[model samples]
Target: METAELEPQVLANRLGVEFYLVRQNNTIGCVITIAALEAHFWLESRASDARILKTFRNGYGRICAIAERKWLARPAATRLELTPADFARR
Candidate 1:
């Protein structure tokens, strides 16, 4: 899973979300857009596929927390809020 070689859409589909690639100066990173149980938020990473996946596995709580806060700030009626528990079951 060499993320640099895969298309953004492919990675987004695999992760069940939308992704955007951001390039600033000489740096490249990813912003993942996630729709949960009534809310949507983003996660970003400049790491490789393996590292990002590892974070998804081990740091989901932090991700969920970030999403939740973002969701709370801008509540939406059409999206869902997802927790780390939801991701664990996926």
Candidate 2:
């Protein structure tokens, strides 16, 4: 897929999540947050790279799985305070 065809915010809206653009060390990436689980997943992709769309798609699937199996397993209150690192250790 082409980068131009992949709009992060559009995907997030389709998934009913929040999307943010982040920059670190001169690199730009997308951070997707699932409000229901308070879970955040980051996907690093260059806007100029055509492969970014594929990367975004894969990351989106991973985040969905993590949110469902890991975050959703906990109580809603616990999920509200959970972080991405918490899922990684599980």
Candidate 3:
């Protein structure tokens, strides 16, 4: 499935933000930490949820691509977390 085709429902938590990517009728949980956002995407530290969502939206394409690659690597995994290294690799 193409993660870019779907607009994920984003949620904020104590650690960071979480979203889902659908693949073959399955929902794969994905998370990107606030620290990753700040370090890689220029998100402000302690950003508001709205701001965080905006950052995610701004970087949606790249983020989704990475998530897609990860999902393809581990299809059986129900959840995935994006780290600074993931962003840094590209």
Candidate 4:
């Protein structure tokens, strides 16, 4: 999918995560999930990282590490996103 056309809320719903907007320089970054487990991964990286490149080289372990160890998947929300101020305090 195109970053310019990224439907974060749709992705959130598909991934079963609470969607939140994160803006910087008036541009939206992502819809990260705050899940304590698994990973919030994206299909492609806008800016590639060497660590991520190495992880992909590791093959299946990459998927396992993300899905099992940390919430590194695309659908995960940010822990800070759903804070009380983001919703009703009561």
Q: Which candidate is the best by lDDT?
A: 3
Backbone-clash count (model 2)? 0
RMSD of 1: 13.3
TM-score for predicted model 3 compared with the true structure: 0.81
Candidate 3 deviant stretches above 4 angstroms: 1-12
Candidate 2: tens digits of C-alpha lDDT, residues 10-73:
3333333223322232212233433322333333322322334444465666654554444335
| Candidate lDDT (C-alpha), each | 0.40, 0.38, 0.80, 0.31
Q: Give Cα distance to truth, residue 3, candidate 3, Å.
A: 15
The Cα RMSD in angstroms, rounded to one decimal, for candidate 4 relative to the true structure is 14.2
- Give TM-scores for every candidate, taking all chains together and pairing residue i with residue i: 0.33, 0.31, 0.81, 0.20
lDDT of 3 by residue, 1-90 (tens): 465634454453546677788767788779887788888899988777788889988998888899999899998897999989888854
Candidates, ranked, TM-score: 3, 1, 2, 4
Task: List the candidate 2 regions with Cα displacement exceeding 4 Å.
Answer: 1-54, 75-90
> lDDT tens digits, residues 59-89, model 1?
4455545555445565542343334344443
How high is the lDDT of residue 47 in model 1?
45
Show where candidate 1 strays beyond 4 Å: 1-47, 77-90
List model 4 lDDT by residue over 1-90, tens digit each. Answer: 355553323232333222223334232233222221123333233323343333333433433333332333334534323221222223
- Clash counts for the predictions, in order: 9, 0, 0, 21
If the candidates were sorted by their lDDT against the true structure, best first, what order would they fall in? 3, 1, 2, 4
